[model samples]
Target: MQLHDSMIKEIEKSKDKIIENRRLIHQYPEVGWTEIKTAALVARELESLGFKVSKGDVVISSKARMGVPNQYILDQHYAETLALGYSEAELQPFKDGFTGVVGEMKFGEGPTIALRFDMDAIGLEESLSTGRGPVDKGFVSQIKGQMHGCGHDGHTAIGLGVAESIAKVRHQLNKGSIKLIFQPAEEGVRGAKSMVEAGVLQGVDYVLACHIMANEPFGKLICGANGFMATAKMDVRFKGKAAHAGATPNEGNHAILAACSAVLNLHAIPRHSAGETRINVGTIVAGTDRNVIPDEARLKIETRGANTAINAYVKDYAYQVIKHAGLMHQVETEIEVVGEAVGGKSDEQLIDIIGSVAKRLNVFDEIVASDDHAGGSEDFTYMMSAVQAQGGKAAFFMVGASPDGTGGIGHHTSNFDFKEDALVESIKLFTGIVLSLL
Candidate 1:
């Protein structure tokens, strides 16, 4: 009881900082690998908190990265972020699109516990309507076409909050070292493998990560998810000859039609008899004007399945669709696997630990082990599997936050928003887990 009180008190002391960080991140949402602004702030805060910070190529291996933005886009975003109030010195560590931070506190001879926090937003416009989103409060995403639709802004805030909370109770942490891992590009499930390949959890005994609002109402906690599907994100581009549409329709091989065909056929992919399968060509861009045939078309696509084999099956078949669709249209097709993650189940023991800790905190109306299927895939599974392979335990918990007044808003949408107080709830959950382990 005394220990729990101490941790809770520490978290309460810094709760304001948590909310402030959340709002700040919400105001300047960065997408995927272009999280320079957010990462710089994270690095600065962690350093101020006295944790040893790692950045740039130090945290992620270069060759292992997938689905990263092209060099030009990254450079432009970095400059824009710098203009927004980040120092070149602070951004230096992650210069050239290598963004993400890992902060570590080492205790003499205890277990190493790692907490992963993804810090990237999805590409979507945020609602400016009063009460429906942050517009009324002036804390809405300032970046156009990018918003923290998945609650990662809140996740990043929780990471910083946990750092401050635990820093207050450092003396009690005599048993283990804590690592706060801030990952990027989790939207496309693109970041974790790079961190894993860079040896982020190399010697960790326990790894825990969480997300906000998996449809659970406020005050409830889903201890962790199982059945997290394996997934692959692919970038497909088709090139063809362009000509005036009306002047010489046959002279042009329209890449847009080829892309449309691919989209239709990709959806027509046979569902595996073994389990579930999913695919979506989320965005397609082709044609400069209506008068001319589009010579180039690009698509953002993703596939998911119950397990690796199933995901692989869909991925292979997707490539064939792209190939055949282009061949059928006489266009040159190019596709690259930009990101991928293998599915896995959470360790029951780790889930048990989270449940017991949550129970002790008394922060929840109901604490339940997640029987929920993680309807989507997460790159964190890569980190979890890596740790478990070395005999470590891991759990990815879910924190609930049902937005007030508005109906349930699904994630990855413009209207997606959550209760601000959920930041404190997340901090408490993480602190609870940290105390249990250390």
Candidate 2:
């Protein structure tokens, strides 16, 4: 399972193309289910590399997809991709939010190894201010209100590089198959479930995924992550009768009042003694005029915990508060579960393999079994849990993307940027992992 020199050379040769694709994806950032262009590029590249590519229903189960944008937004992004010079045929498979691709290359048979890379960007405007590398390099997001605030751009590029490297060394591989999964809508912990439900992990013997973290130094690498919180993202709406505030205040069921009550009480939900828990109402919208009682209100909320039971406890509490708040205010309430992730841990076996591979590569300056996870939620947990349920091993790790040791800028913000060289290191590690396993 030693990585051959040819594989390393192929990865080395792809450095320029890898960076080029990263910048290309970063500049035309798409969010969530609107990743037509990004998926198209990945599909084309994998197809060119002689891998069988699957898309649309084969790659994602439509009914399992969450937090999808409305048809109008989907069509708008479809048209935007077309305007970006991608042909309708090139973007066809990614239409209607069935975004992402799975590229498979089999060499006889052994164990099926899958590598996942997320492809969507956050809904944040790019910073035009100084010190943003994308701004200075003229690759800042061209799309308004959409930017690759995380290192998904780098991850996507690393996936492609690994694909090329693996393709080059296919002759040396005797058995097993490799699957490169380019996922979308990871920001809200969406996308993975649909693909998993579509049977992506059905035959996956080992599933490996990674994230580029700005908080870790450039040469640092974690073999696998820990403390992935179980989480649920929900949207709530309140409907009430509108009336003149002064003249008919009693007739109006205050939707905003119910929303405010729910917000305040949601935050006040007693923290579980079992583990860390979190609740947030990230956005709220209601009302039209000053004198008119607000008729409707909508809230985007999320709850997280160290495990599924704890998260369910928080969700249940939040739900009761929301329901009672609406009833107390005389407004009808509607709650929708949009996204969810269950807690998972990386397999110790895979972690050991990854740690060994990292040490043999002689690239990473720091290697650890696990790093500071801070109980974040990742949709990859869905796939990891799924694969493990089928008696397979799965691991999701983190690669340091900060070169200057400042850990780069905070993610999900306008100023987010990271050292691009992390792309090569990630590709090397991932490609090496594949060679070691397959």
Winning model by lDDT: 2
Model 1: CA > 4 A from native: 243-257, 287-294, 405-407
In order, what lDDT does every prediction score? 0.86, 0.90
State model 2's lDDT. Answer: 0.90
State residue 255's C-alpha deviation in candidate 1, in Å: 3.8
| Number of the top-ranking candidate, with TM-score as the measure | 2
lDDT of 2 by residue, 352-387 (tens): 999999898888899999754646899999999999
Tens-digit lDDT track of model 1 for 277-322: 9999999988899899899999999999998899999999999999
Score every model by TM-score: 0.92, 0.97
Pairs of colliding residues, candidate 1: none
